[model samples]
Target: MSQRVRGVISRAKGAPVELTEIVVPDPGPGEAVVAIQACGVCHTDLHYREGGINDDYPFLLGHEAAGVVEQVGPGVTEVAPGDFVVLNWRAVCGQCRACRRGRPWYCFATHNAVQKMTLTDGTELSPALGIGAFAEKTLVAAGQCTKVDPAARPAAVGLLGCGVMAGIGAAVNTGGVTRGDSVAVIGCGGVGDGAIAGAALVGATTIIAVDTSAEKLAIAKRFGATHTVNAAATDVVTEIQKLTGGFGADVVIEAVGRPETYKQAFYARDLAGTVVLVGVPTPDMTIELPLLDVFGRGGALKSSWYGDCLPTRDFPLLTDLYLQGRLDLDAFVTEEIRLDQVEEAFEKMHGGTVLRSVVVF
Candidate 1:
């Protein structure tokens, strides 16, 4: 039987999300139905509302989430009913070339539920990032559910579904940040803070946070930044280099999608140091660098998609750390609101006020 629930949806371009009735179908083959407990309000969801991601209107917003599996379809062995899971957008197709090569994290063809969740009137809804959980219940491919410790707070660990995962994965997986390394993260938002926390967890000795806000810099320190550079007042590249014995950080992560901030990240890293861009840039956004400088840098320049994360691997490990109090996942949750308050939360996102305002069902 199909279930009816309230969900946030952007019915038109640049329109405020509506908390209206949505119809979720029974799980089809290889799919599952999740009872969402908590869902983070991410910028990606706001992007979908602004029509920034694409022209797809009538979007079911919300992706970063944690929940319990309500039901599973035939052939869905990845997760079973009653399992606590953090929803991930990447449901890797094993037949894809990247997966066949043993790099499932880079699977070229990720998937979603075979059945569509829709408006009560049967109008199809394009779910944000394929696992829209800004609702009471959501349908997803079984592979999207990564089982984590049931004891973890849904509001805190659900962040691993997107921004947090991207940030941490950018440093640990993509940039290969290691102990005794000097790492710098530009942009002190949720993603940047996540990188800072990851660096600390993995024993990066010297962590520098660069941001325009003094308040955010202070918050970054709580996440384990050894030094904070207020970009609004100082020269970011010069400051980062000065803090790293005039050499520069070993790994520089650009979390701000703006091109100017990216250039700062490029120049603020040591020669042969890695630069990881986990920021999501717009389609029209472009950057130009000196070809000679690129050759001279002699370092890896990488773009981290979903933190290059294999959710099944990283989610459980991170959740365990959160449970042990070794990881401060709780620090990311600035406030909790009901589903109807999502529109208000979107306003605060651009104001640089809160790290995350989660919707708790």
Candidate 2:
């Protein structure tokens, strides 16, 4: 049976998200219905509202979520009703070449529910990142739901579903940050802070945070940044180099996703160091560098898709870390608001005052 629930939707490009009734159909084959408990307001949600992601209007926004399984369709064995799971956007197809090579993180054939959720008039709503959350309940592919310990707090650990995962993975998986490595993260947002925390988790001795906002930098320190560079008042590259003994950081994670910051990240790495770009970029943005510098730098430049995360492997482990109190996931939750406050959360997001404003049901 189809279920009716209240969800946040972006009806048109640049339209403010609206809280309205959405019809979520019962799970089809290989799918599941989740009763969303908490969903974080991510920049991607705002990007959908601004029409920056794509022209998929009437978008069911919100993907960073944690929920309990309410129903499962035929052939679904990954999760059962009452299981607590973190909703992942990537549902890897084992047949894909990436998966065949034992690297499902690079899975090229990720998937979502085959059936569509719709409005009262039957207009199909495109779920954000293929997991339309920000609702009382959501429908998604069974593979998109990664079960974790129910003991973990929903509002905090749910962030692992998206931005936070991207950040931490950028440092640990993509950049290969190791003990004693000097790491610098550009942006100081939720994602950047996650990178800082990841670097700290991996024993990086010098973690430098660069951002325009002093407030964000202060928060970054709490997240494990050993040093901070206020980009607004100083030259980013110069400051980063100075902090790294006039060389540069061993790994520089670019979480801002702009060409300028990308350049800073490129030049802010030590010789043969790695640069990881976890930030989402718009379609029209481009980066240009001297071909010689590309050859001269002689290091890896990588883009992190969902932090190159293997949800099934990473989610549970990260949750355990959180539960153990070693990982401060709770610090990421700046505030918890009702679903109706998502719009206000967006405004706060733009102002860069909070790390994450989670919607708690």
Candidate 3:
């Protein structure tokens, strides 16, 4: 029997999402159904509504989430019913080329639930990031459920499902930030702040945060940024360099995903320093830099996919950190609202007054 549950769905391009009934089938082989406790309203969901991600309309929007497993199908052993878990988009297929190469983080064959959730009329829904979670219940591949300590707050740890993981992984996993390394994050939003927190977790000595908003910069400081650079008031690259003893930071993370911020990140790193871009850029956006500068800089430039994370590997560890008081995951939750307030949350997202507005079931 299919479970009829309320979920948030975007029926058309630029249309406001509707909280309507969806038919969620019991998990098929290797699948699991989750009872969502909390789901975050991420910018990516808004992008999907604007037709930025694709023309896949009537999209089931929401990805970052944490919940309890309600059911599991045959062959599903990763998580059992009643287990608390964080949902992840990348359910790595071990047979994929990337997985075979021992770098499952780059897995080319990630997966979702084989059975589709549908509108009451039977129209299939495309889940955001293949893990649509803005619902009372969501179905996903069993591998998509990463078991974590249940002691952590759902609204806080659910952030690991997306932006937070992206930001933290960009620094620790991709940028290889370490003790005594100087780091600069060129955006002060959720992801950039995650990078700052990750840098602090790893003991980065000089962490500089750059942004146009003083409010965001101040928040970044709480997340472990040792210095702040107000891009609106000064040259971002110069400010980062000034904070790093006239030598640019050892690592620069571009979280804004804009050409200007990308350039700023490029120029704000020390020679041979790594540049990690965790921000999602539009296809129309492009960057142009001097060829000699590119050659002379002589450092790695890499893009972070979900912070290059291995969910099973990272989520549990990070949750432990949060529980231990070593990581301040609670700071990310700006406000908590009901399922119906997602549109209002999106509006607040534009206002930049909140880091995250989470949906609590």
Candidate 4:
């Protein structure tokens, strides 16, 4: 049976999102319906509102979420009704070339619900990142539901479905941060802080966090940054080098998608060190680096999509760490708001007043 639920929707580009009734159809083949418990307001939701992602108007706007699996359709075996899960955007297709090569994280063919969730007027809604989870209930491919510990707070764990995971994955997976390594993370937002925490989790001895805001820098310290560089007050590159014994960091994770930060990450790493770009860059933005420097750098310059995470492997591991009090996932949740407060949450996000304002249903 179909369920009618209240959800946040962006009717058009540059318009405010509205809480409206959306009809979620029953799970189709290889799909499942989730009773969303909590969802995080991510920057991607705002991008969807601004039409920066695509021309899919009247979009169902939330993606980073955790919920209970309410039902499953045909051929679903990974999860069952009543399972608590974090919804992920990537539902890897094992047949993709990336998956064929055993790199499922780069799977070119991820899956979503074969059916659509439509408006009352019968117009189809493009779900943000294929999870449209700001609503009380959401439909997704069965593979999107990665079951985790129910004891963990839904609001906190839900964040792992997106930004938090991206940041952590950037450092551990893409940046290859290791014990005693010197790592610097540019931009101390939720994502950057996650990178710092991930570095610390892996025993990185020198963790430097660079951000324009002193408030965010303070927050970074709580997340395991050994040092903080206020970009607004000092030269980021120089400050990072100074903190690392005149040598740049071994791994520099760029969480702020601007070209300036990208360049900072490039020059702020040691010779043969990795630079991981996890921040989403705009289309008009481009970076130009000296070709000679690119050759001399002699290391990996990689971009992380969803932190290059394999949700099934990473989500459960992180949840266990969080449960053991080793990972402070709760620090990422600044406030919990109701669904109607999404716009206000977005404003707080824009003002950098909160790491994340989660919507709890």
Question: What's the residue-level lDDT of 352 in candidate 1?
Answer: 98
TM-score of 4: 0.99
Query: What's the lDDT for residue 60 in model 2?
Result: 96
Off by over 4 Å in 1: none
After superposing candidate 2 on the true structure, give the runs of residues whose Cα lies further than 4 Å from its correct spot.
Answer: none
Q: Residue 322 in candidate 4 has what lDDT?
A: 95
TM-score of every model versus the real structure: 0.99, 0.99, 0.99, 0.99
- lDDT (tens digit, per residue) of candidate 4 on 1-361: 8889999999988888999999999998999999999999999999999999999798999999999999999999999999999999999999989999999999999999989999888999999999999999999999999999999999999999999999999999988899999999999998999999999999999999999999999999999999999999999999999999888999999999999999999999999999999999999998899999999989889999999999999999999999999999999999999999999998887789899999999
Clashes of 2: 0
Q: What is the C-alpha lDDT of each candidate?
A: 0.94, 0.95, 0.95, 0.95
Q: Model 3 off-target regions past 4 Å?
A: none
Compared with the true structure, what per-residue lDDT tens digits does model 3 show for residues 238-266? Answer: 88888888989999999999998999899
Runs in model 4 deviating more than 4 A are none
Backbone clashes for every candidate come to 0, 0, 0, 0
Clashes (candidate 1): 0
